[model samples]
Target: MIRIGTLNVGSMTGKSREVAEMMNTRRVDILCVQETRWRGNKAKEIGGGWKLLYSGADENSRSGVGIIVNSELKEKVVEVKRSCSRIMKVKLMLSEEVLNVISAYAPQAGCDEEEKSMFWRELDEVLTSISEEERVVLGGDLNGHIGTDRRVISRIHGGLGMGRGTKKAKAS
Candidate 1:
């Protein structure tokens, strides 16, 4: 199985040096990053050993996301779509698996419910448009809580409470 990891960089000053540094230890084959805070060639030049295909964010603030894959791995960028200054998409190919990854940092606040709702609605539509033939792994910071605590979610859905504490072994 290929290795994949996601990290919330929390506003990187330049190329997300701190985030990249921490990620280096995991030796990940593919890394999905959020809150990169930069764009264009500047972002590309950061973090060696990986081909950075990314977009989003503006010149003043780096509030976007990207996909950093080990260059040694033979792959192609199928697409890179930016939803907003905060959300971006990176579609890639790995081995026999077509990996479609999205890195998102959503609106967080009691007053931003409208914004959150709209974003979710649009996202749902975007996801639905994809055919099942394509394998997808969308992940990112997602600052807003989605009703249930995410960590508690199991590989098998609707079976446990949030986190390892609430899980029970599947009956034989």
Candidate 2:
């Protein structure tokens, strides 16, 4: 079976080797990464026979998203779409079925409403473009908290989260 996981690396500099080692040890076939804080849009081999497909705001450190696939499945990569610094998609041919994987990073709670709205709108657009029959896996750093009290928002959270809701959480 194919194993997939999501990680918020915060920043990728000086941590590529460590991340690669962990992926190898864990046998993670694919990994969706958020907040990479990396610059540019490109794909590269980051050692340990792993390939990383990444995108960021620009040529400077900032929000970013990426997908890392082990060497065994790298040949199965059919498409890589870097929509923006906060969103990306990768399509892999898994045997007879095609799997669509998306990596998205939401604006932090302190960001303006417009930024948050744009993030959702962009993400929604990406989601809509994919066909219904394809298998899709979406993962990322949401940058929000569900809060400890789930009764009021039972439909959204299951009450196992810690801390109280923040102003942004309440507003949304």
What RMSD does each model have against the real structure?
A: 7.9, 6.7
In model 2, which runs have C-alpha deviations exceeding 4 angstroms?
59-61, 147-172
Give lDDT tens digits, candidate 2, residues 68-146.
9999899999999999999999998888898999999988755678988999999999999999989999989876555
lDDT per residue for candidate 1 within 1-172, as digits (tens), equals: 7677887766555645655566577777667777766654223645565666565555765466777777665247777776666566666776687767776666544335577787677667657766688877777776643333334453333322334443457999
Among all candidates shown, the one with the greatest TM-score: 2
TM-score of each: 0.69, 0.83
Q: Where is model 1 more than 4 Å wrong at Cα?
A: 39-43, 59-62, 146-172
Scored by lDDT, the top model is 2
CA lDDT of each prediction against the hidden true structure: 0.63, 0.87
Worst 10 residues of 2 by lDDT: 159-168
